[model samples]
Structures are given as structure tokens and as C-alpha cells.
Target: MTYRRAAIPALIGGLLLAALLWWAGSSADALRLPGSVGTLGPDAVAELQRWVAPWAYDPPSFLDAGVQGHGYVLLGDDGRDRYNGIYTAGLQIRYGAVFAAFVLGALLLIRRLPPVRGRTTAAFLALWAWGAAAGTLAAAVSAPWFIAAAGHGSHRFLPQLASVTAAGRQLPVAVSLVAAGATVLVARIAAEGASTPPRTEVPARAARLAATAGTAVIALSVVVLSYQPVAAALQAYSPDGGLLAEPGDLLRQWLLLGAWDAPAAGAVVDWLLHRASDVLLLAVVWWALSRLPGLLTRVTLPAMAAGAVGATVLGLLASQLLRIAVVQTGPQQGLLYSSAAIGNGIPAALTCGLLAGVVATAVLRLSLRGAPEPAA
Candidate 1:
């Protein structure tokens, strides 16, 4: 099928799937696995209540029916059974729709673009520019909704999100666009070399080297950029923000913190250790993505997309596990519990990550399905 014809149907299908997943995730709280700390005992219940207080009119109550009501009961801000407002649901819809469009658009653009001859400087510049434009468009379309959501309860749950939400929103879109564009561009370049009459070892090796370097740069840059939020989160534990060490310090803590060495050190170490699970969770995603067949075909898209969703759920569980660990580990005699920080930060990260992952996965899968196979 022509790229456009295939892409349009795929986009529509993705949007539908995204909407379905969003509704199910938000309404059903599918990410809140049973036997999770939040659904366990009295202290856990209270903690869950406090966590939900900002968003819900009433804190979630554990329902032990072992059937339809066998989990935490969510009440909306209006005291309704559901947790989200009309505006909240609308926000999710917009997020899902825009994400699907951006992913599909990038895929379609990549498929439609002329094949690249080699690692031309012009090609790199053009791809970067296109990525920037796509990211800008996505931010423009989605930022208003996110900003609006920010005021509702996001700020309460994730202190300072309003300040950096725009950047956070833009970065993912930009990265996704750049990744998709570069993948296609590099694939085409490789194809060109393969199709040529004379296959020179040097040129092919150069192309492979360049591709590896570019991918590494992009991946490392993203990881570095992500560290800021992690650092900020770790800093929240300190009242005067004294534990507000450099990103390097936080990274060190994340990598090294094993046992409570000292009071101050233990606090930072514990916090970092908690947040570091996200890295492991992300690794799970990378592992799943890697397991996808090397061929860039439509058949594997659904599985990859499902893996994304599954990874998200796993990440949310990881966050909950962090919370459970904190409570179970008990308070260090000399250390103070930064309830404000933990209460505010973890829930925000969990909620946003869960929602964003669902939207991104749905869109990415649809985009992949819509994209045509690379020419042999």
C-alpha cells in the first residue's frame, strides 16, 4: 500500500487504541497492581489516601470484594466514583491524540522522504531542523493542555512541574522525532551503499561508525538531560535543600548508595536509591525494545507497543515498591522524613509517566505499523 493510505488507517487505529488505553488506565487504575503496598494494611491505606488527596475529593479506600471492586476505590474531586474530572479526561485525550499524530507524522515523513546517498552534512542538518520543527509543533499543541493540568493538581503532587513542564513536554517529542528521522535516514544511507555497484569497505565502515556515534550521543544526551529531574527530586528530601548536591553527587549516590553510612549520607543515598529504580525500569523497556525483530516491519509493532505499555506499568510498580521500601525500612533514628518531598514527587512522577507512556506507545506502534518496509 502507498505510505499515506497505510499511515492514515494506522493513525486512526492508534488513536482509537490510545483512547481505549487511556480510559482504562485512568479509570480502572490498571497500573495499581493488587497486593501493592498502597492496597495492603492500615498504614499503607493512610499513605495512599495522603497521596491521592491532592487529586481526589476523597482518598482512595481499599475494597476487598475480590471481584470488580477488589482494589483501591477512587473518588473524583466532585465526590464521584471516578477519579478524574471532565477537564482531566479531556487533557488525557488531547495528549493521546497529539502524541499519536506526531509519531505517525514522523514515520510517514521518514517513509516518504527520498533515500539518502550517504552521511552528507546537509542530510544531518535537515533532519535536525525537521526534528526541531516537529517538536515545536508538538509542544505548541500539547503544552496548553499540560499547563492547564498543571494548575489543577499536578503542582500539588509534583512541586515545580509548572516551571519545567514545557521543557519536559517538548523534550520527548523532539527526541522521538529525531530518533525516528535518523533511523530512517541512516537506514536509507545503508541501503544506498548496499545497492551501489562497488561496495567499498571503508565507506560502509564509516557509515556504521557514524551511525553508532550519533546514536550514542543522542542516548547519552537524553540520559544526562533526564538527570536534572532526578536530582531535583533527590534534593526535595532536604528541608533547606542542603542535600541539593550537584547532579554528579546525585549520580554518585544513585550508583553507590547501599547501606546507611551516616545520617546525612544515608538520607541522600536512600532517596537516590529509590529513584534509581526508574533507571532499572527503563532498562526493562530497552530490553523489550531490543528483543523486537531487527527488521523494521509492521508485524512486530504491536508487540513492541505492548511492551512499552507493560514497561510503564512496571515502572509504576517500581515507584510503588520504592514507597513500600521506604515505609518498611523504617525511619533512621537520626534522619528526618521528608514527607512533603516524597508525598509530592513520587505520585507526580508515577502518574505522569504512566499516562505519557500509554500515549507514546500507542502512537509509536501505530506509526511503525504504518511505515513501509525498507527497500532491500
Candidate 2:
């Protein structure tokens, strides 16, 4: 009966989720400039700004409209068509990969701890709210981090925060609505079965370790997912920030593409270092969580909360140190980067990790309540 109730919402939610993810990917592509603007002339910046204006905002000025018209003329019909096709295709691929991951992760997590009560609906909604807040907060912090990492933008914090806040306010309604609906649908589906399945038990120590690792994965995913929007905000506000404009995957190319005979080798090393930072952070979080007890039970909530906060601080410090070691940079630059990271790291981690801890606990509590105790 519960399963029957969930089907309709789940189907609708799935469709909405697809649309939202695509829109997010499209926004990323649209905000990005055609090429590096480090050496762009004033006319080129004007043209590009006019071209990107429609996506950036609405109710374009007459002058902006005129500039866009000129841009189209410059590109010509054939070039314009080709660019449009590439943009559309890039968005499709970006969203497809992310949406695939979301679906797979959602299903795996749901199956592991299937929702077994109607109250799961409320739980899902709460999780969604927490996630939204977490993303917004990450943007607030990361906006400044973007500038600091670049080392050339305004060092002022208030403007950076305001830029991110404005971007958050401008998010499309469709995206928010669809995201909320999807969360409810996930909740409904997870709670469909009322029968208490047999609870699986592992060695106490092992279960704690697994739970710790899982929590870290959840927290880290939040951090990575927020990067897209934050990056977009940077592009919007500081289009001419040179290397700052093209971080992420482009960082490797800029650093090692020259002066190295084997570009591929450089890429491999770059990838390793990038991943190593993430792994290092993950390990730190795991260690932090391990210090807490009752990892698999309701008692785990406080532990998870505290551990997550600690993990964030430790992780940030560790990553900064690693960056200094790898880059072999002077103390001044290193301190500047570290300060930027800390500025964002504390609040972002606190908000994301705490809320994640709460949500994870809620899911676990529900799952445990539904499942039967293990037999001797």
C-alpha cells in the first residue's frame, strides 16, 4: 500500500530531477567565457559580456541588446549554430554524468537503509532543507576563497559574501521546486515497506569504521558539489582574473602543460595530487569520526556531529600543509591561501557536517526502528 502511494511522486520527482540537473549544467556552461580572457581587448570583453548577459540576468539594456546583435554578426550564422550545438551537448554530458551519480548513490543508500515509515517523508524534507542551506553557505565562503587563491582580487570579505548571496537569490524557482519534490519522493520510496527486515550486524569495531567512512563520503560530496555554483559566481564577478578564471581541471594544464616533455605524465601526476588531497581529507574525517562512540546506533548522533566539525578543521589544516609542500611556495603566499581556506572551511564544514550528521542519524534511527533485532 505504501509502495503504491510512493510510485506517482517518485516518477514525477525523477523527471524534475533530470530537468534541474540539466539546467545546472547549462548555467555552468553559459556563464563560462569562450576562451581565456587574460589578454582580451576591451572590445572583446564588451562583446563577450553582451553575449553572456542573457544568461547572467534578464531585462537587458538597449545597449546590451545592441552588443549581442553585434556579437551574432561577428560569429556569423554557421559559427553561431556550431557554438550552440556544442554548448547544448556539453550541458547534456555534464548533467547526465552528475544525475547518473545522484541516482545511483540515492538508490544504493536507500536500499541499504530503506525507509519503513510514513514519517520518512518529513525526514526527507528536512534533509533537503539542510542540503540547500549547506550549499548556500558553501557558496558564501568559497566566493572569497576563489579570490584569495587567485591572489589578485579585492581582499575585502563583504563584497565577496554579497556576490555569493546575490547569486543564491537569483537561483531559478524551477530548480528549487524540483529538488524539493525529488527529496520527498526519495523519502516516500524509502519508507514504502513496513515489514521489519532482519538487521545485519558486523563486528562492533568494523561497523563503527564503516559508519565513519560513510559519513565522511557524504560530507565530502557536499563540498565538491558546491564547487560548481561557487565557480560560476567567480566567473560572473571576476571574468578577467586570469588563471583564477580557470581553476579545477584546467589547473593541471596551466601548471604542467609547459616546461614538461610529457603532458600526459604531468596530467597523471596532477590528477594524483588532486585526488590525494581529497583522500587525505577523507582519512582525516574518518579518524575524527572514529573517536566518537556508538557509530551505528542512536548514540552516534552527538559523536557524528562533533567528529564532523573536528574533521573539517583538521582536514583544512592538513590540506594547506600538503599544498605548501607540493607547491614549494613562500610563507606569504602559503599563509594567504591558508587563511582563505580557513575563512570558508570553518563555516562551510560546520554547517554541512552538522546537518549531514543529523540527517544520517535520522535515517539510521528510522531504519533501526523498522528492522528486527538480530537473533542469537
TM-score top scorer: 2
Candidate No. with top lDDT: 2
Residues 128-231, candidate 1: write the lDDT tens digits: 32333333333334434443432343323223232322232222322433444444444454444333322112222322332233223223322543455544
Deviation from native of the Cα of residue 127 in model 2, angstroms: 7.4
Q: State the displacement of the C-alpha of residue 200, model 2, in Å, after optimal TM-score superposition.
A: 2.9
**Which stretches of model 2 miss by more than 4 angstroms?**
1-11, 20-73, 117-181, 185-194, 202-204, 210-376
lDDT of 2 at 266: 46
**What is the clash count of model 1?**
0
Q: lDDT for every model?
A: 0.35, 0.41
Q: Could you give the C-alpha RMSD of every candidate to the true structure, in order shown?
A: 15.1, 16.0
In order of appearance, the predictions have TM-scores of 0.32, 0.35
lDDT of candidate 1? 0.35
